[model samples]
Target: MSSPTPPPPREVLPWSRFGEAARELARTVADSGWMPDLVIAVARGGLVPAGAVAYALDVKAMGTMNVEFYTGVDQTLGEPLVLPPLLDTSALAGARVLVVDDVADSGRTLELVMQRLRAGERPPAQARSAVLYTKPRSVIEPDYTWHRTERWISFPWSALPPVTATATDGA
Candidate 1:
């Protein structure tokens, strides 16, 4: 015999809270006293928090590495795929990097991006990771994290419910 399936847990973040969370992550990085010369934001989720972190940390060099992992809610590809245009090594050489992402679920995405960043002859001097949330199942632990939980998170930027049909729903 088997037990019935349980519903997935959920955590919702409002925009205001999201900002605070990002600042909180920035503070964590700042406390480390290891300022990065550049910020590499994982595409999509990382974009917003990475921008906030860069602004807060006063880091002028900000770039993004697009990696497609999540296909839908609680769904993801078999493996994280690196999407181009890949970050140019011309800018990364000798730069210290702070990798930012919204969440580290399985941590595979972070792992993949790190591998890419560290590749090539002139890799960055140092690279650290920061994320708003870290899941218990994450394979890699981040250097800086605002929260650690196992619940599924609904980020403010990606949590819009489907628009209810109105008189002019699709108009």
Candidate 2:
């Protein structure tokens, strides 16, 4: 027997809109007069948006922190787990930092990242967060957000299933 199909996403963020959202989020940050010296992306989901925002803000320094939280659609682990290839917090010292994520849904991941970034002897002088979307129930509200939605979101980068060897065999 086959597993049940997941329901369609309530909101679909196309590639075009993703670009716009990144720019808008960056604008919010710029308007606030807090330009970051470095941009740290919450890897996997946040990589794309972080790059876009960094480009928009002309921030040359960038880093990534890999965190695994959501297991599947609307599914999650008890808490977020930081994956390997960890970011070097040394670079954050005395620099204005911006943490970028695709969405601040549960806010656990963001909270964990923020804590880790702010801990230790060397921490950023000032740290802020940015996201394309934020849920109402989020534990931490990001400094800059492009939209707020409670329903499932189909991000352009994650909308499709992973490409397997079989899928590429004939192509």
Candidate 3:
């Protein structure tokens, strides 16, 4: 048997549109009028977008939960996995939360967070997911999205290629 064929690379270039894109995404959430009491970011990628949305909604409360999905360019685990130390949900008791991620590639990671927030002993008042971009293949649709694209994203924070191992290790 042969290894499954890897997907073709889909590079997205967003040179100067980072802030604009983030603000646009935030607007979508505000327009929806869900009005979260707190903003919870899926760390790494969601950090910026979540902050922007929190500000747009005038939601001062914010938190972050880290999860790992992508391992390398065009590579990912069969399922998105939660990474700890998870965000402290104690403050989220009875608070409506807007969960933010950069993109929803398969939607599993978003689903995990949503379930976690909703199932805890002191579950939140409500929880919703949002993203800057959404792929058609996502298993779960987000409550708010600014754009839809199938291409692998080129977020401003992660646009540059990683430095070679040799350079980092001084080999």
Q: Of the candidates shown, which would achieve the greatest TM-score relative to the real structure?
A: 2
Ordered from best to worst lDDT, the candidate numbers read: 2, 1, 3
lDDT of 1 by residue, 89-124 (tens): 667888889999999999999988888788856788
Of the two candidates 2 and 3, the one with more favorable lDDT, higher being better, is 2
Regions more than 4 Å wrong, model 2: 1-9, 167-171
On lDDT, the candidate that comes out on top is 2
Ranking by TM-score: 2, 1, 3
lDDT of 2 at 60: 97
Candidate 3 lDDT over residue span 7-89, tens digit each: 76764647477678778877877777668888999988899889877887788989999988888766888877788887777
Candidate with the larger TM-score of 1 and 2: 2
- Compared to the true structure, candidate 1 yields what TM-score? 0.89
The lDDT of each candidate is: 0.90, 0.93, 0.84
Q: Give stretches of model 1 more than 4 Å off.
A: 1-7, 161-171
Cα lDDT for residue 50, model 2?
A: 100
The per-prediction CA RMSD against the true structure, in angstroms, equals 3.0, 2.8, 3.8
Candidate 2 per-residue lDDT, tens place, 3-122, comes to 999886587899978888899999999999889999999988999999999999999999999999998888999999999998889877899999999999999999999989989479
lDDT of 3: 0.84
- TM-score, per-candidate, Cα-based: 0.89, 0.93, 0.85
